[model samples]
Target: MGCSACLWLLLSLGCVWGMGRRARETVLGTLGKATMLRIPPELQNLTLHCGEAMWKRDTEDPQRKLVLLKYSGGNYTNFMQGRNRFHKLDFSLEILNTSRQDRQLYEYVVSKASEEEVWQIQLEVYEPVSHPSIQILSRVLANGSCAVTLNCTTERGDNVSYNWASQDLSTSGLCSHNGSLLHLSYSLQDASIACACTASNPISSRVVTFNSSECNYEHGGGAGLRTEQLVLLVVVPIVTVVVIIGVFVVARLAMPRASPEQEHSSLAEDGTLHTIYSQVQRVESPKKDPTTVYAKVMMPMV
Candidate 1:
């Protein structure tokens, strides 16, 4: 018996299923590559009755016809070119430089003395991965530190992965993975350091780097928003309110002191003053009406 797990060999380029008829399985191969799809190599040692064995292919015709092989009567057919060669030494079928057209289901029918057994195989192809790229969420911070976020992506990578690396290929300190499989985050204190991101797939891999020094943290506004800017924006309003309160307290202490008896009294806080006065008046009737006339006096105070 063949190792069930070894029957399928997964490679960076593709896959190959190496097994026999008793344990049938699918075989994966890359395009433009030759592969050996055998039923069971160990079967050669078996002492079973061998009547006749034939190879066949699946067709998409409306009749669901089965296409016979180019080999018949232990001789190669005229239509059988150099692509499909049969090695009479072990009766093995070799398909050379397989193409997309060759990705399909194939069968080998065997006729024995007691019963017949049919072996099947399937082939699949996949495209290789492409060059990857990196994207940073925030490149700079206000305090010269960098809270960096890098995202890696490839053009043709299947289920691609991402990882963060530093100048010496070390840790960038507390990196985290997002719900999105493509993105990664790192927090760096020194903006002068360098970092990189690696993206890979089964077929290929790529790496991209980011220069931390290029991300300068300007005092007012940096290349990207930083965590420290919130403090700067908040401090301005707080300082303004403090200055206004200080000015009010100083003005109140500088006001003048006055007494109530002084003329025009004392000046108000707004610099306005009010005053008060007292007076007396007298009146006399004509001498000719001396008998009915008398001196009259009036007093007025304000």
Candidate 2:
């Protein structure tokens, strides 16, 4: 029922102010989804012929009040064109493609005859959680146990939650969820034990695991990578090795082939060497037949 003061509607606060709040309801929506904010189900069926209806969004900043409509003749601003599609007469406000900016309080006031009713809606728009990444923040060895701390993070998530669980089934660690980050620390005496970090939101969840012994998990490195990334890392080296082997084989095959005649010649020259002796005589004057004679000898291959 709407508040009624008729002529005193402006002079008195009762007419402007809603008689009472039906319920403070929270509307949760995912980003880019459409959600409707309507009057309480109890008041939805009320067929109130309102003379004046005013809707104002409660805002903290000193900007234009997100006033959807404010007039006795049912007038709204051009601020809401395609976004707000529902009229308050039907007691429903439809918002499309809700975004982070759309998350706020919306107020609706409708007066029937002389009475006015108010509805306040709190909207929360969240994004689906993407894959979580876990990396070692710090590690210290104390006594026989190694104290390991890990950080988990994700993108496009709201009210994100994180849990650290161990494969040993005996080791449990405490974690804190601050915004989209999860911090966990564990004391492990055995390096063989493994731990997994799970990031979850109201919409989705993802898990990443790492060995407790080797907590050097980096953002995109280490065993914390997504399956495709790990696959690519493994395949790149194998492909490189294969390509090198292929190139070697191709080069060996492309080399010029030795002919049979060339092979025979190579074999014949492999161990054979020719040797010869030469004698020379030289005369300075025509009278002497020979002034000197020199002989040179060379050894042949055995």
Best by lDDT: 2
Query: Residues 75-104, candidate 1, lDDT per residue (tens digit)?
Result: 544234576766654555667877777767
- Taking all chains together, each candidate's TM-score versus the true structure is 0.47, 0.50
| lDDT accuracy of residue 47 in candidate 2 | 24
lDDT of 2: 0.63
Off by over 4 Å in 2: 1-29, 40-50, 54-90, 101-105, 111-124, 128-133, 137-143, 158-222, 225-245, 264-302
Clashing pairs in 2: 2-115, 2-116, 3-115, 3-116, 4-114, 4-115
TM-score of predicted structure 2:
0.50
Candidate 2 lDDT for residue 30: 85
